[model samples]
Target: MASSHPRVLAIVLAGGEGKRLMPLTAQRAKPAVPFGGIYRLVDFALSNIINSHYLHVIVLTQYKSHSLDRHISKTWRMSALLGNYVSSVPAQQRVGKHWYLGSADAIHQSLNIIEDERPDIVVVVGADHVYRMDFSQMVDAHIESGARATVSAIRQPIALADQFGVIDVDPQDPTRIREFLEKPVNPVGLPDSPTEVLASMGNYVFDADALVEAVTKDAANPDSRHDMGGDIIPAFVDEGTAGVYDMIRNEVPGATDRDRYYWRDVGTIDAYFDANKDLIAVQPVFNLYNEDWPLYTGYTGLPPAKFVHAGPGRLGHAADSIVSPGVLVSGATVAGSILSPGVHLHSWATLTDSVVMDGVQVHRHAQVHRAILDKNVVVDERARIGVDHEEDRARGFTVTDSGITVVPKGSHVA
Candidate 1:
């Protein structure tokens, strides 16, 4: 039985130093990094929470959080008249002089927010994933199951189980979590499906009392990692109060079958690039045009994208790409790419299978292939990036093992 509109407080964890996505994470927090032409990674989490009508939300930030804080403050303003707010709470060393040790410790330090809000249930989610979920339904499942903590789980291949924290479900009770294993070398498959396992999505709903208690206990343990996945959740599993909410059952209003269960943890350069590419598909794996549940962000009031120079050998064309507002593809050929707001591609420049972020300038005759250019990057005339691995490395640009070149923010490539 679902509780009739229980007081819910959502806490978005946005503090991780994304070491894998360097240069992009060089100046900004991972969640604050630009995504999908127009939005930040944290926007997805905040959008879902607000779309689900969970109005009272606080974003927890640490570790180079200035950009993240600015984005949240400017983009996520809710009406104060309705007593609803979407605010970013930075780590203030409330417990002591130390910064946040881990995710659990971050929350433990900011328990004052929870206490002040006095919410019945807390919705804790990560800020670096691309997905849409009806968390209200998860909250209902949490209340109905009578679990102290409920983890949102998605089915992943057993072979790739070592990459994620796998959840072992009780054979007798599908909702009950039998064990929580963090990236185990040899993982157990699901009870019904031997080839698939329930992988934790790092999103959780906790009974307010249970959450506070678990974090408090973990803080006292000397050997604890002070992590929600490593310490707090395991304690709930031991108490038999940890439940699993299958993400497959989550139904959004305008979601299609193709993108119904689409969730991507864009943790690495390759994964992040792939996730953005997923949006530009003919039939996108993750549809962003769903008007029923719109992805909210701070919109720059700019005019529509413009294309010019239709003469021979100077066609300003963008095929199979997402071109955001204020982008001018002047005599350039953009294919299989994303041109973010205010990007200007000059004559004869070719951008293919790449992501060029806001305010970037790809000068005349420059070519960018299979690369990610961060904000305000200036590619000088005829400059070549992502073409030669040796040259890219020699230029001090970060090149991935998969050969994706990453040009950092505000860089001028000559």
Candidate 2:
């Protein structure tokens, strides 16, 4: 039995041209960036959708969406085409040369398609964040509270609150949002800390009728920014029907406790780097190996990751690191690193606290530390990277002030 669950649908926004991720977003959408060795950035959202029992989903895509399109087709083929279960909605040129004028416009343009489905609830989301949540719970909360809309939220550090849409809610009633501001000039303070602020995760749940009305009305507002957080939320907040859901501490099955739910917005290079580093942490905040709440994506039938001459007495060794299938460490030394499939670390190379994506070849005697090497990149022999921030940038690579170098995909080092 499918159970008497609500007819919920997910609308994932993958349209934004991620200028911050740079070189990485040069050829692919932000959501299509490779993550956690085996999955794309979009997989995290899709996994949450399926796991949350929102069988019906439509990914709204634009702006360099070819890679995202191919990825969705390849991995999400299990979805039905004839039904309202699952599909990807790439922005077609039907509306003239102007592509997705804004996030609100994307939905406004797709209003007809959404209307055809007649879903009970529409779960709006961004494809860039990395986290997991059961949408069913949010739906349950929405129904019980009888709110017009609900925004997912999390507590951000005091210093970083200005960078996000700060939310002010009654601490007593965590569900009732008192005020909402989009990247406010002076963020509201948190109870735990006089300086910290609670920020919106940019995820939302709307009653089908409420969503249709809001999107239509917002579209007509000539001065509106055509963004949900900027225009729609504030409009509803004035009516006092908008609610808040603490995604960081939502009492979902897999995510509970104040500190368990890990949510990250990888909108900037620093944020992206921090999120990737979270995966390699001891007892990672985001649990990828949880079988009960398994993540889903299109599977590529690659051979199992292997380690030849591993363990003691071998020229190469990996300690406390995840070596994906098809990786050959050879005589290299890797510590606390993530080596994606088909990575070749030449003999005598050393990799520490780094993420080596698929098909990256580290030449002999080279050292890579606290760096992210994109797919198909080759580091020449004895070439030093991530050692000096100034030197790495001179070589056409990005080096964080902390000395973490980022080599873009298919980059050729001279």
Candidate 3:
């Protein structure tokens, strides 16, 4: 028996050209960037939408979207009998001979989808963030509040408010948004909690009719930047119809106090590296083993990860790490790291506090620490990375100020 549900549509913005995550995004779109060894960044957004029972989704993609398109097509197939699908819509230049000018422009160009689906509500989200959210709850809140639009907000420390788009709710009406601040040097705290500011998580729910009208109007505005956060959201806030959904109220089935509300914007290399390392923690900030709200991804049918002993009391060992399927660790030591599928750590190799992507190989006696190795990277025997910043830089590798070395895809470290 089918239960009654609203006609909802989800739009995932996957077109971001992650300039900060260079080398990694040089080939694939930002959403196509791998995370936690097994899943891409887009997987988090799509999985949340699916878990919330929103079956109709449209992933809007642009710059280097081939892998993103392929991943979505292969991994997100829904039942045809139920009229469910997860489609990837490229920059078709339907309105004009131009790619997506901005987030608002993407929606403006894709208004035909809204007309076709005729959904009552539209759930829009960014594809590059890592979080588990129930958009249905936000939708319900939007309907009840009689607001035209609702944006999900995560509470962040007052000190870090400048890094995000801050949302200030109305003093009288706590749920209504009074202002939308973009990376403000000094942001006012929430009405309830003065120590924290509500930052936009780049997730929104809007009435279908209101959204279509807003985007259409934005497209015609010559002065508008055609952005969701900067233009569309500010317009809504000025209209007094934009409400805020505090994420602290969103409760997941298997959430814990420590891991709950774990939303990370892994846009920059350092942030990306930190988030990946968060998984290998003794008590991870984000729990991937939550069967109640599972993170879905494409399966490669690879064999289980294998570890071999080197004999004579030497052993292949790993601690506080996520070793993906098809990984082979023979006489190697891995600690505080993530090894993607098909990675090979040869004898006498040692890796610490690093991320090794798919098909990467660490040759004998190689040492890697506090580094990110892109797909198929080969570290030659006795090659040391993250040991000397000057050497890493001299070899054309990217070394961040925070002391994290990033090797580009398929590169050889000697």
Candidate 4:
């Protein structure tokens, strides 16, 4: 029996090596990659968990996690006096000589943490998504349903169900999962909509004891992939103990109706670019100024952003953009972009619809349009990015099918 006030623990999985988001992810983990200016991809998940008032968190890290670990340590310092903590746990090959085989394996290897804390309910979430969710609501639903595990799902078009791990709900009980289908062809639509299907969001809530037993049982199967979404959830579904939690129902404080339920899986470079663009809109699709549910990140103690040169052509101006602290726009025009901390745009430089990371330098007359520049990247004088796809490709830059140019970290575009 689950208590009404069950002790809940959160586990943020930040282990996957982001091969799709290259150059930017070259030296850092995917969750460590900067977004919106100063916030890392992982911050959104941690912040949401914290804001939900579940303070006991352990970030699971693997694959070049130094940057992610550092950010968690420095930015997520919970009050040690109160025995609350946000600790980063790296892969130590504790279960065996090999590293983590999959997401489930990652958890199975770190069962020691769960055993130590002995929380009643466990919340598992991916580190690199952009959204605001109140897991407390989901926990309540899970307890009410008395399900062994609940998978959070966002409704997607039935046509696109083949691209995601779709959950077929019990027609009799909409909350219970009938089957956990992975990218199935011609998935059945919802009972009401008939046009949408529930797609797994890679977030789950589990009864702590149930989770421990399931993972321990899964560890013995040599054929299992041990992935949470692909294997474990399906096993629970087969046992008739898995339920689905619709994400649309979980509301947060200070969320605008327009931007509510705005969840983005920024797995690729193009998707990542578009997510940033959503922040700079006139009425941004994703509002960052929601005081009741503010996004938390580390402060670098930098000076305020400065804009100078009001003269005719040398005017420093930015419109419909997000400029972080320590950014200097000295005689430049920025439109529909995000400038990270310590970025400097020189005189006559023009940046349009791009995401510029920390300490980047855009020299005089450089033009960047529909692009993503990684940390410390330099755009030399008169350099043009996204102006020519062929030229960008020839220069070893990545140009996606969507025509978004990506300059690698520390690269000089000349």
Predicted model with the maximum lDDT: 1
- For all predicted structures, in order, the TM-scores are 0.98, 0.92, 0.96, 0.97
The per-model lDDT (C-alpha) reads 0.93, 0.79, 0.91, 0.92
* Model 1 Cα lDDT, one tens digit per residue, 25-46: 9989999989999999999999
lDDT tens digits by residue: candidate 3, 1-414:
101366899999999999988978999999999999999999999999999989999999998999999999999977778988999999999999999999899999999999999988999999999988888888888888888989999988888787778998888998899999878897887777999988999999998888998999999999998999989988999999999999988988897677788999997899999999888776788889889999999998999999997665445888899999999999999999999999999888899999889999999889999999999999999999999999999999999989999999999888
List ranges where model 4 is wrong by over 4 Å: 158-163, 191-195
Sort the candidates on lDDT, descending order: 1, 4, 3, 2
Q: Give the distance in Å from residue 413's predicted Cα in candidate 3 to where it truly belongs.
A: 1.2
**RMSD to true structure for each model, in Å:** 1.3, 2.9, 2.2, 1.3
Candidate 3 has its poorest 10 consecutive residues by lDDT at: 1-10
What is the lDDT for 184 in model 2? 82
After aligning candidate 2 to the native by TM-score, how far in Å is the CA of 174 from where it should be? 4.3
lDDT: which is higher, 2 or 3?
Answer: 3
Candidate 2 ranges beyond 4 A from true positions? 1-5, 81-84, 93-97, 170-174, 254-259, 309-314
Alpha carbon deviation, residue 199, candidate 1 (Å):
0.5
Stretch of 10 with least lDDT, candidate 2: 250-259
